[model samples]
Target: MILIKYIIRNHIIPFLFACVVLISIFLLQFLMKFADKLIGKGLETIIIVKLIVYNLAWMVVLVVPMAVLVATLMAFGNMSQNNEIAIMKASGISLYKMIIPPLISSILIAILLVYFNNKIYPDANHAARLLMEDITRKKPTLSLVPGVFSQDVSSYAILARDVIQESNELKDVTIYDYSNPPKVNIVTAKEGKIFLVPNQKKLIMDLKVGEIHESDIYRQNVYRRLRFTHHKIAMPADQFTFEQSTPGGPRGDREMGAAQMLAIVDSINKVQSSYQKEFNSKIDQIIDKKFNYKPIDTTSNKYIYVKVEQRLRMLENGFTDVLNRIEYNRKEINRYMVEVHKKYALPVACIVFVLIGAPLGTMTRKGGIGMASGISLVFFVIYWAFLIGGEKLADRDLISPFVGIWSANVFLGIVGILLLIKTAKEKVTLNFEFITKRIPKSWKSSDDEIENN
Candidate 1:
């Protein structure tokens, strides 16, 4: 009981510490990419903060598995370096028994992480995607400078010779309106002011003392010129507003919860099955028609031949349509299946890492941030590389979703088991002497430096 408590204590502290450190590191990297989109947009501070929080969900999902690996390595390494493993083994305690407490803890964590991924993670992803769409669509707060052409207003180009910044007014403005293609309108106004209509996606441009030139491609030889004392042009505006995303619409794979994804995949399978059945039935009908044909006379034979050709062409087109629909549904099913497997696959990684980390740490017999970081980083890179490759292959239907998603876990688990066996038998060792022997003898040692002094 005491031994189990001690093991749990050791694992939990490092697990938490590693989680915080890893999350911070990942979040900083994320901010580097995230900041570029939000800067100079004049967004409210609260909105920016909300976006950051929402994006943290995916970061948490990725960070937890790596943190488990780091924590397990550090904990077991510390025990091995301190000779605790030797004492436990001398008392007839097997290495497998020693792993039980931490293994159980990792399983529990994995289970909790599975819930998080399935329930909470999808909503965060959906929210972030929607917010990003809104942000990209929103126009920047307009700042027009004198003697510069402003194209910020939706699809209209405006050039002002001078501006009254304090009054938000423009003077001697020349505008090119190209909202209608092949028909361009040029307007020269003595002065104008732009106003935004509240709650409506519209911009009102009030112009005073302007002459309008209108031309059309259909009327190449003719042009219309008009002078007006006052003219107003209303245009659709890209409002810088954040509206709540609407619900009950088609969502991407990443935007759906696990149940929703499974339901969608099942639905696609049913649809594709129906398409296949329909295609087979049509083929069977064509064959029966071909075999059952009869002719009453020469004229009848000619009519039958023409009718059969037309029917054959129609069947060909129908078969093509059915095949296309089936293919599309299969692709969608593959996409959704990949995501469904991911929800389970990623959480299960915590348990797999525990398997790998425990034995590798005992073999290394070193406990420090540097050692743990180096080993875990290499292993994680390989794991992530395989995961990404598998996902791509699965998406393209090159491999089954199950095989692609679980390939990393299977490979890593096998390696972990082999290492665990070697470590248990006390065969694996970190032989510093073996490594140092490969170094050139010409390299100066501490003893040689002392002799020189």
Candidate 2:
């Protein structure tokens, strides 16, 4: 009972502390990326702060696994440094027994992470994404001072001598459109009434007694025209819903449910199937690209030098094509496999990280929080590198998705087992000095910088 309380204080607390610190650090970095947007949007300071806090929650949820690992290590490492672990061992406690509190703690954190990923993370992500879109939408309601024409979007300019807010009317309005290349046009209206398109986000101006003027700069010419009635200018389809290209947007594969993932895969497969004829036709054009020279039958007469050059060019082209196909095939398989397993693999990383972290901390026997964290970071970097390599292979279909996703976990798990054994036995870990001692005599001296200046 006493030992369990010590675990709670020494291990669990430190782990929670680490989680808080890591979440804050990550949140700051995330906020930094959108600092410009916050300013540009002219959002309320309080609102912006609230959004930051909300967004931080999502980051906290994602990094829970890492925090659990670091916290476990730091707590245990502290105990080891203070001789608490040594005392426990001498008191007939096994390393496995010492790990119990941390193991329980880890399971709790994992449950929270699963809950956060499914519920909180999605809500936070959605809010952040919506905020970004709103900020970037940039709808400016400018009050142009009579004669002063304000440049809105590129090629469109607006001016009003006077504006009536109550009636939503403009007097002495002028529009200059220079969107067309090598030409410019200006329209002047004496009176205009504004109309908002229903359910669409476009504002239409009905102008009366408007004179149109045109100019050609390259030819150094000007043309004048007149119109008595109303003209409708094209506006972006913000008011009305329009279909958008959906490669990966807010509702991308990452955020999708299981059904969505399957639907996307099926859709992509359909596209590939439909384009099968196109790919087959590519084979016929393949030979033409290979040979630089015209067909022998068409040319009839080819010099010996031309024949050699053509043959060499064909060989080079063929070599390039072969290399391209090999590279492309490898990448395609790698990506496909990695993506297929990502949802499952990433969440499970929490458990794997904890397994590796616990043993590593015990082995180091160093309690400094920063030092433990640094060690954890190094391990994470190594794990991340393996993931990146596997992902690259899986994305291109060069490797199976299952292999790509679990490869890092498998490698890290084996490492965890080895480290666990070493730490449980308290083996002298291999470091630089250990390796240095095995080097030739020329690499070291007894009196020269040997544990002293």
TM-score of each predicted structure versus truth: 0.81, 0.61
Q: For every candidate structure, what is the RMSD over all alpha carbons to the true structure, in angstroms?
A: 5.7, 11.1
Clashes of 2: 19
Candidate 1 structure quality by residue, lDDT tens digits, 150-170: 787766888888876445577
> Model 2 — which ten-residue stretch has the worst lDDT?
239-248
lDDT of each: 0.83, 0.65
- Tens digits of lDDT, candidate 2, 1-453: 888888878866776788788887887798788765555333567667656865875577556767767877787777777878779889989777887776776667666666565555555655656555555443233333566786644566878888765465779988888778778788888888655466546656678888888888886755668676776555443522222222334563335443445566566565555445444445555556444455556645556457757666766676566556555544443443354465455556666776677676666677677767888888778777877888776675666778876888788878876777777786443234675688777656654666477
List candidate 1 stretches off by more than 4 Å.
141-183, 186-200, 203-213, 224-234, 244-248, 289-306, 431-453
lDDT of 2 at 362: 65
TM-score of 2: 0.61
Among all candidates shown, the one with the greatest TM-score: 1
